[model samples]
Target: MSPLVQPRLINGPYDDPGLILDFRHARRAILFDLGDNHALSARELTRVSHVFVSHAHMDHFGGFDRLLRLSLHRDGPLSLSGPPGFIERVEHRIRSYTWNLLDERSADCVLAVAEFDGTALIRAARFPARRAFAREDATPPDLRPGLVHDEAALFIASAALDHGIPSLAFRLQERMRVNVHRDGLAALGLPVGPWLNVAKAAVREGAADDTPIVIGEASIPLGRIREHALAVGPGQSVAYVVDALGSPANEAAILDLARNADQIFIEAAFLDEDRDIAAARRHLTAGQAGRLARRAGVRRMTPLHHSPRYLDRPDALRLEAEAAFGSEP
Candidate 1:
């Protein structure tokens, strides 16, 4: 079967932790943890409307400024989500920069920041903060396991885990399903046109009616129109996890979020030989990261957020992780 989702490692141990997932067929795209994002050009950045940050670590957040700067006057609103202190961190970034250029620009951009704090959620915004902005806490929502953001087709879910501090793992799922049977359409002497829109609306709303679907003045029963387009397909899911120590207490929570992910991006800062150092620093060794991936039963695991010390020996680190996961290359 053709893969429903495609993931490109924008930047990683080879550079910074940036991944671009092309949900083109699903009518959306997602960027996970904006590290050095040179992999994505200005054109690609403009197309992405949703970004998920794993934590505030420089490698993970450094490219955010550039992303915001590039998309300053774009068409749609940008939605950013992360663990606690995310809103404050973003506001601090905006305040630290000069905004004269933003003010003069024609783009009226709005930043919506969502932060998860276990039982409650907080959200706020800054219009390219012109002055020294103080962090304001907004009304919190119940942070339970369900759809957090429900846009037209995009849905997001999050769960909190301890990383010496509050850290979060986010999953973005596209709930729109598109299906059509070519043979069925051919047999019915129906030419596919805008009638698909009515069928799609019915599917999305889960209701069917006897309304006549007029295609260029030709009428067709909604029930017959539904037959050619009614089919159920699987949705796509991508998970991002970073900077959490692999602990028994945190393992379940992390795995529960990562299990069965089509593409899982996790951190592997140390090798198994340095397990002690990893434990002391609250980072995961390559082996530990692989074990977690195996436990979560993910399809593909990309290990990132490497310590600079292993910069010259990245292959060694990668192999160590692959070995732990019983995978080669």
Candidate 2:
């Protein structure tokens, strides 16, 4: 099955931590953290429809201004989600700028920001680009657990971690993956075309078994297509975690949020030699990140946010992580 999200690291571990999740098929993308995102082109920036923040740390949010400027005149509304104080942070950024000279030239652009406490959205606000980005309180949804944001194709869940302040780790999972078997299609004598997508959708949506599926000159039941050419199973999942302390509470939260994740992008900001410093600064070390990935049973681990202290011995972190992950050098 084709992946629903194609994620790439925006910067090296020594720089800042950021990830770009390209949902190119949908013509939209999601940004995880707002660190130095200059690596992404203008077209890529404009494709970002939503941004997920891990915390309010400067490195995690420094790219907000760039994102705002890039989306200032875009047609679609931009949304931001993060831990508590997210709305205020965005509002403060907006207030820092003056827009008195701007008018209807860019009147339709809007920005929505939501603050989540664990899984519940505590506060929400919207800023209209045309109106100088003024804050407007919006109705809050009922307190929910597990899921913070939901979309038709996938859902995002969060868990609060200890960063001295609350930090959130996010998990993005597709609803379900529907794949078409080429052999089955060949057996059914159906040509591979756009109609396959319809069949896949039918499988994803659990359409009625007897639903008609037209292909070329003949019509077949959706069930026939499934039995012949469609395969459905659990969808793709990726987790993003950063700036979290290595503590018992944080361990539990990270494990729960990132459990069974296909890929875990976490902070390994220090080496085990500086474990004390990492703990003091509320950040994870390479060993700790590997331990979390192991305990969570994640398929793969991509450690990031390495501290500058390890610049001279970068391989040490990778070795430590690989050791904890039970992989040979």
Clashes of each: 0, 0
* Candidate 1 weakest ten by summed lDDT: 126-135
Residue 116 lDDT (model 2): 86
For model 2, name the residue pairs that clash: none
Question: Where does candidate 1 stray beyond 4 Å?
Answer: 1-5, 26-28, 101-105, 118-120, 126-148, 181-198, 204-223
Displacement of the residue 320 alpha carbon in candidate 2, Å: 1.0
Q: Which prediction has the highest TM-score against the true structure?
A: 2
lDDT of 1 at 150: 56
TM-score of 1: 0.82
In candidate 1, what are the lDDT values of residues 70-107, reduced to their tens digit? 76656456777667788878888877866654443456
lDDT (0 to 1) per candidate: 0.70, 0.87
TM-score of 2: 0.91
lDDT of 2 by residue, 1-329 (tens): 78888989998878889999998477888999997889889889989988989898999998999999888768768989889988888888878988886566774778888888896888888888777777788865554486778866888898889899998899998889887798998998889998877877777787999999888788899998899888788888999999989999999999998999999998888888889999999999999999999999999998888888878887778778878877677
Cα deviation at 160, candidate 2, in Å, is 0.8
TM-score against truth, every candidate: 0.82, 0.91
Model 2 off-target regions past 4 Å?
A: 141-144, 180-201, 212-220
